[model samples]
Target: MGTEHRTDEHRTDEHRPDVDRALKADCASCFGLCCVALPFAASADFAINKDAGKPCRNLRTDFRCGIHTGLRDSGFPGCTVYDCFGAGQHVSQTTFGGTDWRRAPDTAQQMFAVFPVVRQLHELLWYLTEALKLRPARSLHSEVRGLLERTERLTGLAPDELEKLDVAAHRRDVNALLLRTSELVRAEARRGGKDRRNRRGADLIGARLRGADLRGADLRGAYLIAADLGGADLRLADLIGADLRDTNLSGADLTGCIFLTQPQLNAAKGDSATRLPPELIRPAHWS
Candidate 1:
């Protein structure tokens, strides 16, 4: 994938689309591939050790987690974040025609292999769908849309094709769109030329603060959990001890956020979409 690109142009005010088009649990359209196809060690994030291709002991015969309603309480928080990006449903219904992994035991391994591939394609879809909503990236929306369509089509390919999926190339294409998105959002971050600060314990939850300038601010001990910080500017801000649990930092600029250590974030929560600086491990709690 390509590296970062900087540009000057404000387009954050354009009407972005709602991203809920992506799939959720819709068990009727999926085979619970994630629970069986992925491996997890016995840890705080999972209740038991399960190897790749092995279904969790708690997985019901009907393809639902036996502990679905209590995954967090049962030490399987990671299961809560295992979104298939609609690929699980696509594979279960469209590509494989609603085949059950159990009934067709012969295709089990193939299904396992294709699950991750479809997942990558679907994750890219999430990003492209999000990029399309960026008004600032309007100049590149056509290209972004093209990539989204192509990536979406790949998710419906045969198991053989999906097994050989070129996810890296698709990621490169999505990164191109994101570069444009960053340029558009970052331009808005430089507005007003007035550095703003928020005090501790401020109620910033669920605030639509995309692309806002927040450099050099004191957000220490702030209650910013679950805040919509996508595309927000956090260059050189003091994030020490800040409560970032569930804060959406996707595509947001944090090139030089001060005191933003990995442990602090590991103590919080985030997803695969979050773009953290190097040397940071994804917070284990995010799952």
Candidate 2:
């Protein structure tokens, strides 16, 4: 595989902090941690069952995917949609001091164990950074920035410490902050006379929400797993921390869907008919 190139033109403006770089996946700077550390079952997304701590069959010695550009055609569509939020590179270059797991086989287990924890922390940082940018959440911006700093610090923990850390507890604390931010932002729609749909952390499994107008709705931490959201209008909706697994988004217009991460979209079920923001690439399994 060839080296990947990322131009700074796609980066945030000068007014924003440098955290955006750390929140974007940089595969070239990574050690293919996601390929080796994460397990995947043979499903619609993945063609094969890969055990945790075991390197993927297509991972090269240089820590690059053998079928990088052709992952979807090669039956590894799940790989193409994954984003570590720069945790892979941080684990490779900083956490482990540039030591390849192949060269230091003894450190493999610990490194693999630490990767997911760090990945979770990095994910929080990604959302917090996004929240800080929302003008409506300006009152919470200082706190969001503080949480972002703390989350970034958590990623830099020693491997043993990282493995021992209770990441779920950390996520709980951050989710609360995100929920507050979502409420503040979505309040605008309520003031505009739109329905005040506060479905935060609700069990919406298998709910019928077709053609529902959810513009600027606070959907943070909502359990939308396998819900039928076909043709739903989710513009300007805050989707941070929402569980989108198997959610039907066919014909859904998410043009201004705020804080909707790529991983969330990847976990959901959508089709060619689904509309998405320009920043989000359509999922391969949607075909």
| Top candidate when judged by lDDT against the true structure | 2
lDDT, candidate 1, 156-247, per-residue tens: 78889989878888787776666556555445444667756545468787677777777645565677777877777776455644676667
Cα lDDT of model 1 overall?
A: 0.66
**Per-residue alpha-carbon lDDT of model 2 for 38-71, expressed as tens digits?**
9999987788999999999999988888988898
What's the TM-score of every candidate structure? 0.65, 0.83
lDDT of 1 at 234: 75
> What stretches of model 2 exceed 4 Å from their correct place?
1-15, 201-208, 221-231, 243-251, 267-287
Q: Find the number of clashing residue pairs for candidate 2.
A: 0
| Residue 17, candidate 1: C-alpha displacement in angstroms | 8.2
